[model samples]
Structures are given as structure tokens and as C-alpha cells.
Target: MDNIISKLRNLDAYPKINEDFYSRTLSGGVITLSSSILMLLLFISELRLYLHAVTETKLVVDTSRGETLRINFDVTFPALPCSLLSLDAMDISGEQHLDVKHDIIKKRLDSHGNAIEARPDGIGAPKIEKPLQRHGGRLEHNETYCGSCFGAESADDDCCNSCEEVREAYRKKGWALSNPDLIDQCKREGFLQRIKDEDGEGCNIYGFLEVNKVAGNFHFAPGKSFQQSNVHVHDLLAFQKDSFNISHKINRLAFGEYFPGVVNPLDSVQWKQETPSATYQYFIKVVPTVYNSVSGYTIQSNQFSVTEHVRTAEVGRLQSLPAVFFFYDLSPIKVTFTEEHVSFLHFLTNVCAIVGGVFTVSGILDSFIYHGQKVIKKKMEIGKFS
Candidate 1:
């Protein structure tokens, strides 16, 4: 056992010091204390960082197919009423959704910006049970009634019972309801009166649009939209006005699910119309993102950059209509975010380096001080240095 102990002691990196050569100074003690404190502080900082999760980002080419993009939006039009405002979405592939209602909610706001009512889209009108007129007159008992489409009907049996139906029929015929006052359905349904009543009220539209992953545009226009001459046009006559206010405030506009540290550039964005008849356009480039949290939760979203432009309406020329248009194109590259924490082994290694490095530096400083003091003492005793 004694032979083994001798061998172990010889192998020790730090040998025991003899008491006769031992010396301690105030400066050395102070430095030792300071280095120890510094090492502890550094170790604590590193440990904290090691314990917390960090997000690492990587970019790759997106090769997804048949994936749909979700657009979540909340927009407020201070001058346009919910009845007059319409939502339309169309893609480069020729798919179109007019007066989009599903998954959409509309809030009626007073001039003060307070919400008065919250309801789904297309909730204003009550459903009619039967057609009111037969051959342009009231139906008699046991008489079959067929509403007229005012020359827009595809067949003689086609019926346009409501003002909206008549308008839709006209849209299909590539014709506008030039004079709603002359239409019996519009007069009875008080469509013109409804527009007048909603004047000065504001609308807050919050909805989600699910669209193809390809490039396309979605717009917020004053009236229902239709295709005429291969061009998208809104029924301006429905509002009983030639111009509209395209001013809007975007409360929230997110491309997909929210993730940690994700910032949507268009949130809380506002624009005031200088002219009543103007077009507000946003050109957007979308980058897909996927986030995987340390807890194994995943979120798929998109980040975007946008450029805005506005064009005033002109009478003679083919002026851009008053609307808020969002044209978005997808990026081929996709970003991935992963949350990770430092391993226990790595944390321990860093701690050891900090402790060993600081101790070695402090010991070297103490050793130099002690040796300089010994040399000076010998010089003074020999009377060779004063």
C-alpha cells in the first residue's frame, strides 16, 4: 500500500508545498479571490445559456406539391360598410372566388371604431321562401311563378328571385346592372335603400383565405366582382356612387401559423386615401418557413416582403379601379428553424476550461510576485542594491 501511495503521489500534477518556502501576500489573496469570483460568474452565464433553447435556422429548396397557403387577415375600412365591401380571390391557374363568404367574419363598426355587431359574411338579408312576382306581376293562388332575369337568363326556366340573384345573372352575362332603380327585384328588396342606410358606417373584415401554393392575387373591393372581357371588374353601380374610399388599416396580416420570434411586416399597417378613386396595391414575395420547437411542436408559416403602389382613377383612360390588391408570389427556397440546447457534456467541458484557465493564470501571477520579492531581499542583504 505504501509503494502504491508513493507512485500515486509522484504522478500528482500539483505537488504539496513545504511550509518553510510558503509565503502569502495581500495582493495575491486579492487576485485569487477576484479570479475565483470571475470564474464563478462566467460559469453561471455559460450554464444559463446551455440550459436555454436556441433556434437554429437552415434554408433548403421547397419541393412541395398540392400544398395550400393560408392567409389570415384583419382589415378595417373606415368609410366602407360591410354590405358594400366584398372579398375576391383569384389565381394564375384561373380559379376565382367572388364575394367569398366561407371562413369569413364581418364586424360592423361605428364611426368611432367601436364594433357594433359581429357576424359571418352574407348575413344581412333574410332568405325568401317563394318568388314574389310571376311574369312581372304578383302570383295568384295555385299559379306557378317564374322570376325574370331581365334578358340575362340562360334559359326561359331560369329564375332570378332576389336582387342578388339578378345581379349574379347580369354578371354571368358580362353585363352590369346599369340601372338598379328600374329593376323590380332591386326596388322591392330595397337594395338601394340598404346602401343608403349603411352609408358612413365602417366595416372590419377578419378572415382566412386558403389558396393554391402558386402565384395569385386577392383583393378587397367596394362591390361584388365579376369577369368582363377577361378583366376583373366590380359592380360600382351597386354602391350608387362612381367613386369609393380605398383607405384601410390592416390590423393583422399573417401568411400562416404564428411562431416564436416571427414578425409579420404588414401587421398594424394603415393607409389613408388621398383621392377617393384610387387603387392600393401590394406586391409581395413570400418565403415559406417551418419551425420545430425543442418540445417537438412544429409550425409552418411564411415571411414576406412587400412593395406598395397607388394609382388614381381617371375618367377617359382605363384607370385602375378603387381596391386593395395583394399580389403574392412564392419563393422556391424554404427556411427551417430548429430549437436546440447545449448538451450536458459540452457544458461540463466549458466549465472545466474556465476554472483551469483562470486558476493557472492567477497562480503564475502569484509565483512571479513571490520570486521578485525573494530576489530583492537577497540583493538588500548582500548590500549590492539599495
Candidate 2:
């Protein structure tokens, strides 16, 4: 045991010197004090860095497939009435969400932009269990009456019991309900009166749509949309077409789940139509983002960038109707952010480097000052110094 101990001590790199042989000077003391202060400052800086988390970002190719993209939006049309406003979404996957009403809320705003009433997207009351009419002649109260679609029915025995069913039948036939006053279901449900009730009012629509993860567009336009000759069209005369205004303000628009420090470009965006009849379009590029927190939790989200364009309507041309369209496409590259703290071993290594570097530099400077003074004193004594 004694021999082993002696062998280990022989391997020691630092040899101690006696204090009695030490020669300390004022310059040496000053350098020691300055170097100590500098070393302390450096150590404090390193400690702060170790305590705080650092975010590391990297880009990788996105290879995800068959995923669903969720879009959340809160838009306010300051000059469009809720009765005439409609929401539609379509993707490249051949899926369509037209006149979307599920989980949607609409707020009626007066001319002053203040909310007057808030309700779900559907304007009318619930569909009555009993049918409203059957044919040109009124059926007795005890008869099992069946409503009519007024030539829009697909089959002879088809029945349109409610105003919504009547509209659906019209949409299927590629026919716009040009005159709601003539439809018995519409007249019974007071649909035309509802449109006149919200005259000169605005609308605030907020909703979420779950769509296929592909390039697609969702738009806010006036009137109900239908397909005519395989082309998407909206019945511009459903409401007051001549008085349509496309001025709108976007309160919040996000592509996916929320994450910390995420920035969405289109939040709180606003646009006003300068032309009498025009269209507002937003082209958006969505980037998928994955965030890994220091606590081992991960979040899947997305960030987006947008560009706006306006197309004015020609005097007699019908290239497009007044609407706000958001066309989004996904990016092939995905960004990942990782948050982590410095490792214990790494922190210790840096601390040692800082201390050793400062100490070695200070020793060299002290030696230069001491030896320089000694040489000058010897020259002055020999009278060689002028």
C-alpha cells in the first residue's frame, strides 16, 4: 500500500514550492487581481448560458403522406351580411366542403361593425317533423303532406320537407332558386324575409375545417355555390348582388395546432376593395413544423406565409365574382426546433478552459513586466540609460 501510494504521488503534474522562496511584486498583485475579476465575469456568463435553454433549428425533407390538415379561421366581413355570406373549401383530393355549417358560428354585425346577434351558420329554425305542403292544392291537417322542390326534384316521388332540402335539391339540379317567393317551402320557412331582415349588416364567421393534407383553397363568397357544366359557380343574385362589398378583416387564421413562439403571417390581416366589384385573393405557403421541448414533449404545428392580390371586375365580364379566396400549398421541406440545456460535463470543460486561459496569459504578462523592469534598472546603474 505504501509503495502504491508513493508511485501515484510521483505521477503528480503540479509540484509545490515553498512560500519562503516566493517573490511577490505590486505589478504581480495587480495582474492577479485583474485576472481574477475577468475570470469571475467569464464564469458568470457561462453559468447563465448553462441555465437558459437554447433552441436548435434544422430543416429536413417532409415525407409524410395521407395526413389531415386542420384550418382554423376567424374572418369578419365589414360590409357583407350574414344572410348572403357562404363558406366553401376544396382540396386536390377531390373532396369538397361546400356551404360548410358544422362547428361554424356567425355573428350579425350592424352598420357600425358591432355584433347584433350570434348564432350557428344555419339561419332558419329546426326542420319541422311534419311536412309543410304537397301540391298546388292545400292538403288537410290530418293528411300526411309531402313538400315539393318545385321542378328541382331528382325523381317524381322526391319530397323536399324543409328549406334546406329544397336548396339541396336545387344544387343537385344545377339550378339556382331564382325566385324563393315561389317555393312553398321557402315561403313557409320565411327564407326571403330572413334575407331582408339582415339588410345593410355585416358578418363575422369563425370556424374550423379538417381537410386532406394537399394543395387546396377555401373561400368566402356571396350566395350559394353550385356546379354548372362542371364549373363552380355562385348564384350572385341570391341576395343583393349590386350592393355586394368585399371589404374584410381577418382576426386569426392558423393552419394547424398551436405551439409556443409560433408566428402566423395572416393573423389580424385586413383588406378593403377599392374597385366597385372585385375579388381578393391570398396565396399561402404552409411549412410543417415540429417542436421538441426540453422536457421531452413534442408539438406538431405549422407556419405559413401569404401574398395578397386583387382583381377588378370588368364592366360586363363575369370572370369572377366578389369574394375572398385563400389558396394554400404545403412546403416539401419541414423545420424542426429542439430546446435543450448544456450538459454538465460540457459546462465543466468550458469553465476549466476559461480559467486556465486567463491564468496563463496573466502569468506571461507579469513575467514580461518584471523582467523588463530588472533590465532597465541594470542599464541605469551602468549609466547606459539616457
Candidate 3:
């Protein structure tokens, strides 16, 4: 009992020593608390960075059949190859062959075997007449006849006797007589025939004739197949212009069998088809891999790989992750593709930012308050000892 009382009385005399010890202890405590909070904030920040590295993006492609194929995947993956993709055309079916005749005859012939000539009266001419009309005539006994007519009697009013004079007059005026040589010249010149029959009939005319030799059926075959890669994501989403060529022979006469209502095959057919279809369907398979690293408190995402369909006619577009990140490692690690996978990363990043912000502000305020308190407490201690 005496020893315990002696210890209690000596405790009051040790105030200076106790005061120094308490101040040191409080300072250490504050430092330790601040350090712990900083560590927690760093951990949260790291978690947020991991979430930002992995996101999914959309992929799309246009095909030759005017079809569009869309798929969702990461942006970092490569497209697939063509042979693995399949295509089945629904509209064209069955096998049919078309036959056409190339040999055709083109000749001009008259109604009779013998080529006819113009008559002396400038009528029924096998050759075309120049301005087909008669201009001049002779008067005989007050009756009109051709300029070569003769009178029946030797009368003073004989217009036939004056026929020679009128004929000469008309000839001098550049009028054409019924000359056999002129008619022959016109016939040999290959002019279009304009003939007046001996019965005073009208002109005769003729035109060309055409014949068609069509086959019973038509044929269709598969065209060349190709693959395209490194396609831009924007081009696939909208309509685009594209073309491909197919080498094949088409029969001229049987062209109607395949292309109905086409008048001329050589003129109407495009030897090579232009403007491929703007829509396509694609089947994309994607594998996502992630790699993350932390260097000096900053996290970064690395490269990734992907497999996809790359055929022009069969499939288009590919699959990939929208975003990706690694967690404290540099080696690539495989990850499963999921629709809701981004939620966790988003939540973690946000929480880290919030916690980091709060702790940083609190530390600043606490540091100021601790420094002020220390100054005032030191003054109080000094005054007590004095």
C-alpha cells in the first residue's frame, strides 16, 4: 500500500516528460492514419483503371447481294478468312442451257429473177425516178399528149406538127426526156427502186427482214469468289458502291432466253457486271484476351487478337471487345465475351475516383488543423512550465 501511494504521488511530478511523450504519440498517430488512407485511395484508383481498359464495339459489313451483316466485338481484333464462310443464293435455281445460231444471211433480191429496166415512156422503171413526175405535154386537135405525139391530119391547127418544136423547147429548158441511157445509169447506181407498173399503178417499195433463233432454256453458274480485309467500320454501316467481274460467253441468238426483252445482246450486255449489292450477312466469332500493367501508379492496356469471317460474298464484319485492360500483369490472358461485363469495371473506376478525391481533400484539411493545434499546444505547455 505504501509503494502504490508513492508511485501515484511521483506521477504528478513527471508532467513535463508525459507531455513530450503524448505530443510525439499524437504526431505518429496522425501520420499513420494519413498513410493508411492514402494506401486505400491508391487501391481504389487502380481498380478504376482496370475497368476502363475493356469495352465492346460494333462491327458491320456489306455484301454483293445488297445485304448488311452486323456484329459486336472488340475493336482490336483481326478479320476472319473467306473459305470458312458459306453462301447460298435463294432467288436463282435449277440448271438450264441456252443454244443460239450465229450464222445469218443478209441479201437483197427482186420479185423476179431478172433485173427489170425502165420503159421508154419513163414508167414502170426498175430504177428510181428523179422527182417522179411529168412536166410537159403536146397539144393535138385541142387534146394533150406526150411531146412525141403526131397529128392524124395535115391541118394548120395541127398541134402534133408543132410537137417537135414544143419537145425541142422543153428539152432546151433542162427537161429530161425518157432516155434509156439515163434509166440504165440510175439502175446500175444501186439507188432504191421506185417502179410504176405498166397498168398505171402506184410505186412499189421494200424493207429489210430479221429472223431469231432462240434456245429452249437458259443457264446460270457460280461466279468468282473473293475475300476482303481491313474494312472500315463506317463503310459497312452505310450504302457503298462496289463491283466485280465474271468472264463468260453469251450466245447472241439465245440471249433472249436468259435476258428477256433484250433486243441486242452485244449492245445490251455489260461484258462485266458493275455495282455489287450493298447488303451482306456476317457470322463473326470473337475471342477476347486482356493484359494490364501498373507502372508508377498508372495502368495501361496492351494489344489483343481476334478471329472473324473475311469473305466478300459469304460473310462480312467481325467480333471484338469494345474496350480492354490488364490487372498488374504484362502477359496476355484470355477472357470470356459477355454483354454485361462493363458494369463491374465502370462501378470500380467511379468508386476509386470518389474515394481518392475525398481522402485527398480530407488529408489537406487534417494537415492544416494538426499543425495549428501543435503550435497552440506548445505555447500552452511552455506557459505551464514557466
Candidate 4:
């Protein structure tokens, strides 16, 4: 045992260590040294590659108007890498000749390839530039031709005609047939007129003749150099004609309910304008259609009039609202319109890649720092043992 101890001491006293000891120390040092060196080398290579990418990157954009734009980015080391390089170019001069032939083919197939008939080629009938004149003659009223009664012809004088049948059917439900005066009022005012007697028993009676004159004569007046411009006058005229038809339908529906009686006779009526500055106002006219024998009369108004002033007020209020709020979807109402637009996929893809790369780089750096500290602590322990 003493000899063995002496041999062990002699081994320790030697200038050179044993092969196993040297090998283990060298292996551990190489592992730590190589890891640090490799990490630095990899980091430097990545930075250079990133810088190169940034310096060479470019983008080009072209538009239908023969305009072009080119953008260049400056190359940076840690701040900017080749991978971060970006450039934008825009060209605004190319003609966008939409290939609508495909759409036409699709539509044709949908229609079973039926040949579309072409509109007749000729000058259309002369437009009615002036309003129809109102004659002073009274509209003839025949008992057999009562407007309130359905299907009553002027030539038919029979009391048991279709009109009488309809009236008899209403009489069974306590609804008296409209009288001659009420029928005449409908012809003049374009609505059913109701009149009440002193006993509160009412009859559909006509009395007043209301005439509405054309408020304005709107005609298209071409500019002084109309012939020189590319604007098609015929197209404009067609548009105006269509617009007039639409406007007439809307106006008729809006104001038709108020005719004969402007206010409800059953209830105490009240009127309030939403805005005084409004060029157009919507006037609600409520009328009681169903009469309650016990409650005197139950008036239920559901009609409204949209005057020109109301439209002006709405447009003025819109200006005060924020553009973002106006464009945001806050209501359940959904509107869709067909229009050509650019795709947004490219913008989304770039944004995602940039965010992902930043996180990946940060994680790699943290790992390197943590591993380096652990290796240094191990080396210190090994030195103390030596």
C-alpha cells in the first residue's frame, strides 16, 4: 500500500499529466472552444448574407399610364441585412385591357348559347321635352263606371254589375261602398276621399280637385363645344330618361299615401322637423284606416314624405363623421358592388416573414449566451481540482 501511494505521488509530481487526463481536458476545452468559434462564425456569416440581400433587393411597379417607379434600399450590418433589403418600383402606364371575352363566353354558356337579339337600329321616338298639358274639362262620371268599384265599365248601366257585387261583398263587412263624390275626388286627387256626416257615420266622398303643375322643366343643354367633346349626348339623354322614371316611381310611392287627407283626423297630430337646415325633410303622415266603434277611432300612421330638403341635411351631416368610422362596418346591412381592384396577399406575406425572422434571431442569441456561461463555470471547477 505504501509503494502504491508513493507511485501515485510521483505521477502527480511529473511535469506532464497522464494521457487520459490530458485527453479529457483537451476534449472538454475543444468542445467549448469549438462551440463558441462556430457560433461566432455562423453569426458573422448570417449577418453578411443578410446585408448582401438587403443591398441587392429591388421592387418594380408598373401602371397603365406608362409610368414607372424604382425604389432602392441602403445595406446595413446588424441594423440592416441582405435578407432585410427592400425596394419598390411602380409603373403606372400600361393599358389594362380586360379580357372580358371569357366573361362573355361564360354568360353565353349560362344562357344555353341562345343568340342575343340586337336592339333595332334606328332613331328612337322623339323624347317628351314638355309636360302633358292639363285640360279644363271635367272627367266624366258615370254610375256604372265608378272608379272605387272594381271592374265597372262606363258602357255597363246594370245595377247588378261586377262593381255592385264587390260593393255588396264589402257591405256584409260593415264597409259601405264609396259614393259618387268620393269616386270623383279619387279621379282628381289620385286617392280615396272619406267624409263624415253629423251623426259620425262616414262615407267615401269626393269634393276637391287638386292639380299639380310641373315644378320645373329639366332639359340637357350641351356645352358650347359639345361636338368637340367625347361625351355621348345620346347616352346622357338615356340616363336622364331612366333617372326620371325611377324618380317618378319613388315620388309616387312616397307622397301617394298622403293624398286626399294630409293629416290624420282620428288622432291629435304633431309635426317635428329633424333639422331646420335640411334642404329635404321627411314628413310622416299618420292616418287611422280601421275605426273602433267604442274607442271613437284608432289612428295608425305609417306613411312618410321625403322632401328635397331632407336629402341635403343628410349629406351635410355625413361630412362631420370620421372617414374611418364611415367606412367601418357597424351595421348588419351589407352592400356589394362589382369593381376591379388589387390583391392584398403580397402585403400580408411580407409582414409575417419579417416578424418571424426577428423572433428566431433573438432566440438563437439567448441560447448562445446561456451556454457560454455554463462552459466557463465548468472550466473553473476543473482548474481548482488541478
Quote the positional error of residue 186 for candidate 4 in Å.
1.6
Scored by lDDT, model 3 comes in at 0.28
lDDT for residue 348 in candidate 1, whole number 0-100: 92
Compose the digit string of candidate 4's lDDT tens values, residues 254-310.
112232233322222222223322121222221112111222333221222222212
Mind giving the per-residue lDDT tens digits that candidate 3 earns over 1-386?
99999989898855555554444447557766876787677766666665554433332231123321111111110111110111111112221111111221112123331223311111122222221112232233534332222222234442322322332233333232333223222333322132212111211111111121111111111111111252111111111112212221122211111211113222222122222322211221222222222221211111222221222333465432111111111122323221223466666776667676766776676677788888999999999999
Query: For candidate 1, what is the TM-score?
Result: 0.89
Kindly give the stretch of ten consecutive residues in candidate 1 with the minimal lDDT sum: 123-132
Cα RMSD, model 4: 29.1
User: Where does candidate 2 stray beyond 4 Å?
Assistant: 1-38, 126-132, 358-386
lDDT of each: 0.87, 0.87, 0.28, 0.26
What lDDT score is found at residue 193 in candidate 2?
86
Q: Could you tell me which 10 consecutive residues in candidate 2 have the lowest summed lDDT?
A: 123-132
Clash-forming residue pairs, model 2: none
**In model 2, how large is the Cα lDDT of residue 32?**
100
Candidate with the larger TM-score of 1 and 2: 1
Error of 2 at 141 (Å): 2.5
Give candidate 4's whole-model lDDT. 0.26
